[model samples]
Target: MLNVFTPNRHANNVLEIKPEELKERNIKGIITDLDNTLVAWDEPDAPEEIIEWFRKMGEAGIEIVIASNNNENRVKLFSEPLDKSFIHSARKPLALAFQKARKGMGLKKEEIIVVGDQLLTDVLGGNLAGYYTVLVTPIVETDGFWTRINRKIENLIKKRLKRKGKI
Candidate 1:
């Protein structure tokens, strides 16, 4: 049960996940969370560094799909400008959205990585779907009301994982 919340890898931020390392691991596709994972939840656009990171991944022949539980308009607004694929209102930890994104990528299960800032949605969802998971630190300390609740729960889980040396 606790294993579902554990990420295969952790990074301080998305930028710390370099294209070179992914390429080395033969990672061809990424299904990543939109808000907080890529940028602040309330932030409207991608910053320059993030844009460059996307460009670098594209140049490395990696496909990216933005998967968010946020509304379609919000996800569409963010993804279209970057010319990336996306799945909105993902209902994650459910496997369907992750599978849809993987199918769209036309990649094998082992070739994709799932990344986000949350354990409940991202890590558990990715693990349940059998993808390599990367849990990046949330871009901001503050979260929306619901996320704050999730974070409190995550803290308890983290403590247990820490005690077991599984984090």
Candidate 2:
């Protein structure tokens, strides 16, 4: 199942993607991870580039919701518009959060894209929830004890996926 890890498809942290590309692909919403996928975990505020990207994506009519393992405080502080709802205290690698995020967007599984940096949590959870998954590179390498363990496991999956030529 970890064959879902696609390293080459990871977008730049600056969001090099054009909104039109996602629109043409029929993706109505994006469920993104908070820590590394959206911003550097240690960074206290969202960068100007990220703010612009979110604004552009919103202007293009795409719904974006954050599905983060971080606590509600962190997620709320991160996505300050308070306009879009998010799944905080999310226990990833579980389908519940993905389900909640998709339901929050009022979008079908097929119309949503789950973007994150981890294979086990992000890709696997997104796939299990029946949404398209986009695995991105970590925004910053340093992590907590638990996250370090998860990253190790994700690295193993990534190597196996590469051997299988799935990435």
Candidate 3:
């Protein structure tokens, strides 16, 4: 139902999600989307701010794993330099990739949070997998070809959710 697409929390961007708040919530790990969720879809790498965010999370002893639908090369390239774990070609909106990321983190479902920009992929997938989900606004308003299609559908869903005041 619509609840599956609704996030438990929302933030303007990933940087707005503070480590202190997460720690207070007892969330020890993050399963995050890569492209527009963390940076522009076309961005080749993480920018300084994103890097610093990762550093903060690390300093707080919070583990992070990137789960991206993009190819291995793209995900690996972005993740390796950050020295973070990743799952590529993740096929989001499916539970398998989320499960893989959770298992890799070795964190219980209650100890993890899923962060992403898209509801169809990120929120739905995370909710279905029984994890707390945070929907951060995409770093850029623009999206890649396939994501644009999802965005259109997401807009419609958002409107409905708004009418119901569930978002």
Model 3 Cα lDDT, one tens digit per residue, 1-167: 89999999999999999999999999999999999988898888899999999999999999999999989999999999989999999999999999998889899999999999999999999999999999998989999888999999999999999999988
Candidate 1 regions off by >4 Å? none
Question: Listing every candidate in turn, what is its Cα RMSD in Å to the true structure after a full C-alpha superposition?
Answer: 0.8, 1.9, 0.8
Which of the two, 2 or 3, has more TM-score?
3
Models 1 onward score TM values of 0.97, 0.91, 0.97
Which residue runs of candidate 2 sit more than 4 Å off their true CA positions?
4-8
What does candidate 1 score on TM? Answer: 0.97
Arrange candidates, best lDDT first. 3, 1, 2
Model 3 steric clash pairs: none
**Candidate 1 local lDDT, 1-167, one digit each (tens):** 79999999999999998899989999999999988999899998999999999999999999999999889998999889999999999998789999999999999989999999999999999999999999999999999787899899999999998898887
Across residues 59-157, which tens digit of lDDT does each residue of candidate 2 receive? Answer: 999899888898888888888764667889889878899888888888888788888888878877777777777877788998756789898887787
Question: Residue 163 lDDT in model 3?
Answer: 99
Model 3: lDDT of residue 140: 90
Give the whole-model CA lDDT for all candidates, comma-separated.
0.93, 0.79, 0.94
